[model samples]
Target: MKITFPHMGNAHIAIKALLAGLKLEVIPPPPITKRTMELGIKHSPEFACLPLKISVGSFIEALEQGADTVLMAGGWGPCRFGYYAQVERDILKDLGYSFRMVVLEAPDFKLSELLNQIKDLSQKVTTLEAVQATRFAWFKLNAVDRLEFCLAKMLPRVINKEEVLAIYRQALQEIDQVTTRPQVNQVTNKSTAEMEQLQQHDQPLLRLGLVGEIYTILEPACNYDIAEQLGRMNVEVYRSVYISDWVNDHLLGGLVKPSNRREILTSSRPYLNYFVGGHGRETVGNAVKLARQHYDGIIQIGPLTCMPEIVAQSVLGEVGEKEGIPVMTMYFDEHAGATGIQTRLEAFVDMLQRRKKSNQVWEQGEQLNAHVPGC
Candidate 1:
């Protein structure tokens, strides 16, 4: 059967490899765009969180392309993500979309169990092959993640920003086409090494804390290239979500449900009972944490109409105020454009630089005045 998967951050390539190993055809949903958001908003529940809406949009787009199966992740948490796949599946089924939605659950205790499901996918699905594929996928993922972390650094400084982006796209293309496990390892190592070597200057990079829905933060398309813009402005971007977070949210959180539940309940004791919504509490927690660290600003991104992120953004203002941090909220709709996002980044970066310079000048002036016996 033809297979598809909804886009998640930068996961398209890794998932494609895993599915390819499983001997499936990959019809990746379109790179997220305005039309993508429109499709999602039109079909998904209006009140659903932003990430879910975008996910629904992605699946609909894939379905429209005649894809018959969707490979997706399952989760467990106060975060609605645990239930997102099931709810979305039923929603699409009700809409009369013909497709199979396969949600991969927490890893089974037995390695044999993991191998069996994996073998069912690969024509040559042996225990060895499964292990190889998983390892390859993991290292490649880490390399990709680190590239993002590094790019998030280079991005804020790139002149003719798109110039460096052109190079990054080329680098990603190089990383994605390797044909073997050894090649995957080599590609990951080489690409990461080169990204590290890219030259940089010493502008005090605006320390921008990234707190958002998991999918959007990880997936470049979902944010419509917001991170690239931030990087071009020489902003040091800090991310709150990671593959590790996904593992914890779904894997460990499942094993320690009561403890996890209690932690959520207690931490959010100030808000309502913990938000079962995606990334809402995480966003707030990340913002508060980053502000405490003295990040220059915080940018919270989520799919449009995402309740968790919206609620998080609602409280982040207070968090920023209490901690003396600047917070900017970026909400994306189908029609979101790079130019508009660029405008905001330019404005935000400019403000941060100006404020920083002003503070420095005031302090210097105070020092000079004291020395001159003036005031």
Candidate 2:
């Protein structure tokens, strides 16, 4: 059986390498595009997470490429992500597609359970082999995400916009071929060292932490590649969610949202127990951490109907107000506009710069309706 995972961002490299190293056959669907979103919107539930729809479209595309098995992460919570795999699978089956889906569910705390899910998710793969695959998958995911973080931190210094993407592409390609930890570290270190050499300056550019739902924040096709766009505009950005984050969230009870109490209390041993649900609370904590480190601003991105992010939206607003930081909130969907997003981003970045100079910040609890329909 051939396995395929949905595309999220510039993460295909490390993830692909993990599969390759494990000798598991896997494929990634094409990047989200106008046609991909169109198909997703046409077939999926109107209120579904934009990522889920894009993922469905991605799976269908992969199936066309001779992939018969799909792998997806599973969850359980107030968030809709918990039910995404089952729903998407049913949708695919109803569309007359013949394929097997492997969903790794949360609420199973044991490492053994996770390994079991890995086995189950990789249809036709043996349990022992699946355990090995999980380790490889983790290595690939951590490597890719850390590389992204390093690149993001360096983007503000990249004078040429095209060069940044070129370097990014190069790193992605190199990572896809990596096997051992030393190889992964060497690849990342070299890529980041080059980026730093190219992006050196006396003063850093505006640093913004991006927090929100998993898809709209990570998938460029869905959010119009906002992070790349932000990087081009000379804003250093950090993303909130990742494949590993989801894995940890499900495995560790939940992604703590500090806005909630029980989660924080239950998380005594863990330093980040305050993060209650999703990246909303964690986003705030990260922003506070970044702000204390002297970052310029925080950007809170979310889907319109997503309750966790909605909770994040409000709490982050309060956080921004109290901390005297400039925060930009944008809600995205199928109807989101590129031009508008860029324009608001420009304005926000400009505002952040001005606020830094004047020692002033956005009014407490101010709301910007960067909202679009169908989110």
Taking every candidate in turn, the Cα RMSD to the unseen true structure, in Å, is: 4.5, 9.0
TM-score of each: 0.80, 0.82
State model 1's lDDT.
0.71
Tens digits of lDDT, candidate 2, 19-75: 654566877677667677777888899987778778888888888788888878776
> lDDT of each structure?
0.71, 0.70
Looking at model 2, report the run of 10 residues with the lowest lDDT sum: 264-273
- Tens digit of per-residue lDDT, candidate 1, span 46-165: 766667777888889888898888777776655667788899999899999888888777665644554566666656566677767765665566656766666666666644566556
Q: Which candidate number has the best lDDT?
A: 1
Instruction: Give the residue spans of candidate 2 off by over 4 A.
Output: 18-23, 121-129, 199-204, 251-277, 360-375
